[model samples]
Target: MSRYQEMAVFAAVAQAGSLAAAARQLDLSAATVMRSVAALEARLNTSLLLRSPRGVALSPAGETFAASCQQVLQAVLDAERSVLGLHSDPAGQLTLSAPLLMTPQVLLPITLAYLDTFPEVQVVSQARDGMPRLLEDGIDIALVVGPLPDSSGFAIPVGTVRPILCGSPAYLARHGRPATPDDLRQHRTVAWTSAGYVTAWRFCHGQAVQWFKPTPVLSCTTQQAAIRAAVAGLGLTRCLNHEVHRELQDGLLETVLDDFAPERLPVHLIYREGRRATVRVRTFLDFAVPRLRTHPALNG
Candidate 1:
């Protein structure tokens, strides 16, 4: 068994908890993964993994080896990337993840344009509505909105989006428009709970911050679902300015309480620490950030 190949396979399995997930990620068969793991264990003269009915767990030996393998494997990739002619040209697959709503609002357009510019690079997009650990999930880069939890990683604040209080014209007609944070309490509201709290909506004018807890008429796991419910006139909903920019422009929805809009929520492009900032990733950020700021709806 090739030592480097074994290291790569072990690292893949460690990153992906299941053999099936590792196989799919590596574009290999489950049998191949099993064989590689077996070969590695034999060469090391230690059982690295404990297989059971539930799933595979790394033994103490495996835990020590996995971290070393990741470091070694990353060094190898870095060396190869440095020498590879296409490395400077950014010719490789880039895996990205973001919230479901941001997929259409921000990432999709940038990805489309990126593909057009770098035909040699393939972009794979994953929708992770809930916060995802970039390294654990094997995501090359992640676009995160709102504040992030404590983690060891690199974050680039590319831009920000302001939340807009909006609803379909029909819904506003029925529930009445909220002119201030206090008015939201009497209005039917669509709540998006997957990202964070549903009942609390914050608004600010100058230094004063006021929060409102609306009577949620509908709740959904995703921002997209909340926006959809609002579009269908189920209830008033709030979302990032970019999420409903086109809809508002096309007269599908209308914004209310713009004067009392909340502070700009941060948008970030984050990646694991020490992952080489590839030329492709840098290029996309350079192009996308400036354009995103100019977008009429987003508040930079």
Candidate 2:
């Protein structure tokens, strides 16, 4: 077998933690797996696995070697993809663009898990401020929230998220809950303004739409910063449901104006093409679509 093949075998063994387990995972015979592992150790002049009656474990050198193995293997795959193009193997780079708020909270964990699951696939995640041009940007997929003005891709509806107004229990107790968006004037409002001084919060109940411009006690550039300030009892903050998912679950914040919520923005996984897509893109979309659809962070 080739050196790369040997490294792949050893890496699988390290991950599975046993020769038999790795063999099963790779769909290779136990004897072939064992031979590959032995060959690797002999060639490197190092003892990699320490076998026990129960199972096998990586030695100290093996642990360090395994980490490098993953890196090297990924680098090789990346190079191969660049040269050959992804026709058959689900191994290559996939670029995903998304809104900044969705990246860390709603997308990072899933992407990290995808990397683990598809060992040969590398991900490039871009946090976009505006709608992405997938074909122009060479992006494989985009996780978008809300309406698309361009609407030029194959969209897979994932879920929905709405703008939420929330405040800490302490702040609510100090200045009773705002019954309506207009009542926010009675309370300190923390508005998210990247470059502006004021914010017009729109509320929609059925067909009636109302706009309330809050005089913010504190204005933040980032949604997370606004949420933090609100959590500290500074004031009520407005953000998407995905932003305060953990906060709501942990009881750090409570929703204030559910009845006046403006609109539920649909989340979509937009890709440039369907059948013509690379194997890397197809596999990634299949992995991410269902996960995002059911994730509580974005779901209404």
Model 2, range 1-300, lDDT digits (tens) per residue? 899999999989988888888899999999999999899999999999998888889998898788668656865765576578654567666788999878988889989988888888778899986688775565779998888766658888999998889999999999999888778778898988887666688899899999988888888888789999999999998888987888898999999989999878888888876776667777788888889988998776
Deviation in Å, model 2, residue 199 alpha carbon: 2.4
RMSD of each candidate relative to the true structure:
5.0, 11.6
Please report the candidate that would top lDDT against the real structure: 2
Locate the minimum summed-lDDT window of 10 residues in model 1: 291-300
Residue 288 shift from truth in candidate 1, angstroms: 3.1
Summarize candidate 1's per-residue lDDT along 1-300 as a digit string, tens digits.
Answer: 489988898888987988888999999999999999999999889999999999998998987888778756755665687786546666666778988767886678878987898887788799876577766665768888888777827777767788888999998888788877887778788988865556678888888998887668888987788888988998888788878877888888998999888878777777774456666667666766676666564553
TM-score of each prediction: 0.75, 0.70
Top candidate by TM-score: 1
Q: Kindly report which residue stretches of model 1 are placed more than 4 angstroms away from their true locations once superposed.
A: 8-36, 42-78, 148-152, 195-198, 273-276
